[model samples]
Target: MTSCGCLMLEKVEGDASAKTRVKAAPGAGAGAWCGSCAGDWRGRSEAIFPIYVMGSSRESTVAAARGIVDSPEDPIWVAVKAEAKSEAEKEPILSSFLYASVLSHDCLERALSFVLANRLEDPTLLATQLIDIFNDVMLNNKDICRSIRLDAQAFKDRDPACAQYSWALLYLKGYQSLQSYRIANILWNQGRKVLALALQSRISEVFAVDIHPGILSI
Candidate 1:
């Protein structure tokens, strides 16, 4: 699910238990898409929502975007690093992973770029090759970067399992998967559909979650 200049509805990766995906009932116009079972739709798209927003509605997504969508210099980045540093102190073996995942990146964008690039790397696009592209999207594209923060904030807001931002950043495959999709979506919008599909395939392969490019809603 990539960004489009036009308003588009996305069909998120479906859950087996869900009989059908839902959108907001009519009359909400195009601004709202409320998922009753376990998601929502907004400018953020369900690619990011199901993992972060959970069952939240458009209002929640908007509020999250308003509140936590800070720039690459957010203070929370500092706190996340501190938490990672403390955790590393407790578990030396995982210290390298923690550092590379969160502590090393100065901001959420860099961290997300690193995470998504590595996760989506394949024979065609090595992690090193994808890292530069992912970093460019995460840093230069405001919407995708903001979606990462909103999704992270939503995970904290909606999922009791998400006890910490660092946990979401480092541990959750759902969060990572959605962010990876967001980058792919960006690539798709840039007319790099082959690269986008390649990343999307890697996401499904690595995360066990598949979102069809054709999942459309009215």
Candidate 2:
């Protein structure tokens, strides 16, 4: 793996008779292969050139090679991730849940989408479908994104029971329901009344809080 934890496959040039060697790129750590990419490459001469593994694409590999880092993350999201990690360490039973809901995602929006989707998903409505809907609305609407962060902050600031931002994000039903309503409202405004109503029904079923999607709540 590279210094950035991205898997880098380097081809070793040698005699025609010699087998092509697969090794890590320059500046890679010792035994650089991550678990996903750890395998025998012997006799696989056809596997020439570098194969980027995990989240690293060819473009990302080139950027990493040039020592380029991704843009800075939102501070609220950074804190949420840190708190989730610490909570996971303290509560081993919740490790998988924390990882899946927070650590596995790159940003707050994605993580929140996953959480809400899973929570509201039913036999008829799959989590994957809900994720797409949630991602669409959350990613496109700047106002909703800002509201989500502010809501999370409010939970942490006002709710004495809410010790961490991740707590509000991951566990609070009220917070989750509020976010669901926000997405549903956007869908309703966009003339997707049927889909929005479905989401509203699901939210009511899951969170036990019924709110009209058409109503513009402040």
Candidate 3:
């Protein structure tokens, strides 16, 4: 097993409990790191958190923060906006200043919504979708004019100057493979026998994470 920080990614050619041997990073606490690190939906109580507090709607920020802390398992959650009844409360809202923050990126919206609505068993596919969305938004969202450049600059400043600096790291280290098999395990646990079998083959080809014969026997 290879370790990063306190987290470990096991090389389970096909172990039933392979994923359960690892721990999820604090940032990834909400999402299942693997089999063993499955945590409750409620947020972690760790003192250090990853909340982006740039220029954004305070209400939205608070709501988003609360959502992350409160519902770790949720991929998406709807927040209620407060309507102003008086002019004093109706201050003109400016554009979002959280342009470069990973959490604030609009590409994450769909996956979040999907996760919140359903206790999604697999975030691998959703994570891939999020990456594609980010690429599309960064390369083609033309309405923002100069803001796009500003946001792009911000991301460059905040992140390492590498192609796989973001969540794509999941694929680089074969985390995506574990996620797929975990999803398949979930389906198998849920008694969706046919679907589980179908996923097994797909996951093998896509992730290249082998399922060992001994692990399968479990």
Q: Which candidate wins on TM-score?
A: 1
- Clash totals, every prediction: 0, 1, 14
Model 3 spans > 4 angstroms off = 1-165, 168-170, 212-218
Error of 3 at 165 (Å): 7.8
- Per-residue CA lDDT of model 3 for 1-218, tens digit only, reads 21332343333445454322335565554333454432311123111222422333347555644554455453221110111112114433421211222234343333222221122225543645433433433234333222322332233323344232232211132433443344445446556667566556655665566663223311
Q: Residue 97 CA error for candidate 1 (Å)?
A: 1.4
- Per-candidate TM-scores read 0.67, 0.66, 0.27
The residue-by-residue lDDT of candidate 1 on 45-65, one tens digit each, is: 455455543444568566656
The digit string of per-residue lDDT tens for model 2 on 74-167 reads: 6678889999999899999999999999999998999999999999999999999999989999988878877787677667755777889998
Q: Listing every candidate in turn, what is its Cα RMSD in Å to the true structure after a full C-alpha superposition?
A: 9.9, 20.0, 18.2
Please tell me which model should have the higher TM-score, number 1 or number 2.
Answer: 1
Q: Against the true structure, candidate 1 has what lDDT?
A: 0.69
> What is each predicted model's overall lDDT from 0 to 1?
0.69, 0.78, 0.35
